[model samples]
Target chain A: GAGVSQSPRYKVAKRGQDVALRCDPISGHVSLFWYQQALGQGPEFLTYFQNEAQLDKSGLPSDRFFAERPEGSVSTLKIQRTQQEDSAVYLCASSLTGGLGNTIYFGEGSWLTVV
Target chain B: AQSVTQLDSHVSVSEGTPVLLRCNYSSSYSPSLFWYVQHPNKGLQLLLKYTSAATLVKGINGFEAEFKKSETSFHLTKPSAHMSDAAEYFCVVSEDTGGFKTIFGAGTRLFVKA
Candidate 1:
């Protein structure tokens, strides 16, 4: 709506369990990004999408970390077989265009804890 | 390759005192630099950015950063510190090489003492 929105603000998952987080970027934005932030650290880029096409997935930590923006509007990040080390905050951001010159807006983020 | 380094892990200042947060970056090409602030349990908010425009970039909340190409630094400064300014600050660098790649610094935590 007004800004980037994320779902499941907080999540607790058992080790080896699968979890999904959702993000809704600002309407009509053309670029979307996902980042992972650990305690006391800055957010690290996970992946990027230009419209519905996934142009870059190089930053995904592992194969288990999958993100998809199927329709170019809403996106989802899925983590399989979650590990304790995977616990962190997942941030979603969107920009008006697909480059670095534009200002990217961020969501509150989804906090995940693996137990 | 592009990278950003925030010099201090933590900084403490009394309310109303001058504030400074240092940042340096390395980029292969002309880089876009940015400063973002994150409050407790809140999303990141952009403070300011320096593209190819003015070297002195002003942002909201009385924050400003100057892009120095000679030293490859974009340090953030404020004339005075406010209690509300206590938060984590991050320096970011972006370079477009086929992909829009962005790198973030480790972050500096600002503590304002009253």
Candidate 2:
């Protein structure tokens, strides 16, 4: 079975530009999550979606960050006016259920660089 | 708030030697613990998890962790290290304070020497 996957493995953008990263979760997965990982640091939660309803967006750092999963499978994280501080890897993960203890699988992540 | 701490930023061991990765967690409520491994240029992979079922948890590739509620610790250990074990290890904690949220530690880099 195919695990979670992201598109455009690498992206470079100038500060103040807008960028979108896509994620295709595993088939039949009901839960999706987004995380941001800075160099030499662990991933930090960005948002979470259960099916099409976003259950959590508390981890999003600021208003410039946004995410959506309209069809309940694929998701996209969009950043408006990208900042130099946003240069990091954006990771996507999915799980079978919305349970707190459910095992979440991750994608290779989209590496974004803001200059 | 829930958080996880990985004591060592890096650990190096010779092949066939024992491997230990220490992790401690702090949570207001009972938490679900997990260990994830990330090879260079790869995604994170689940090694094991403790969901309040057992104190001693076993995982893949000869790995295991003991959950101590008193100490608030869930340290990962392997009897023998393999060259392939060189990677970054993260200790994670899941809590349902308001909704399901997972937190990750700083990660420990494991270097296996021949």
True contacts kept of each: 0.69, 0.78
Per-model TM-score, in order, reads: 0.99, 0.98
Residues A1-115, model 2: lDDT tens digits = 4999998899999999999999999999999999999999999999999999999999999999999999999999999999999999999999999887899999999999999
Which docking band does candidate 2 fall into? high
lDDT of 1 by residue, A1-115 (tens): 8999999999999999999999999999999999999998899999999999998899999999999999999999999999999999999999999866789889999999999
* Global Cα RMSD, each model: 0.7, 0.9
Off by over 4 Å in 2: none
lDDT of every model, 2 decimals: 0.95, 0.96
Best by DockQ: 2
Worst 10 residues of 2 chain A by lDDT: A1-10
Please give the range of 10 consecutive residues that has the lowest summed lDDT in model 2 chain B: B94-103
Q: For candidate 2, give fnat to 2 decimals.
A: 0.78
Give the per-residue lDDT digits (tens) of candidate 2, residues B29-64.
Answer: 889999999999999999999999989999999999
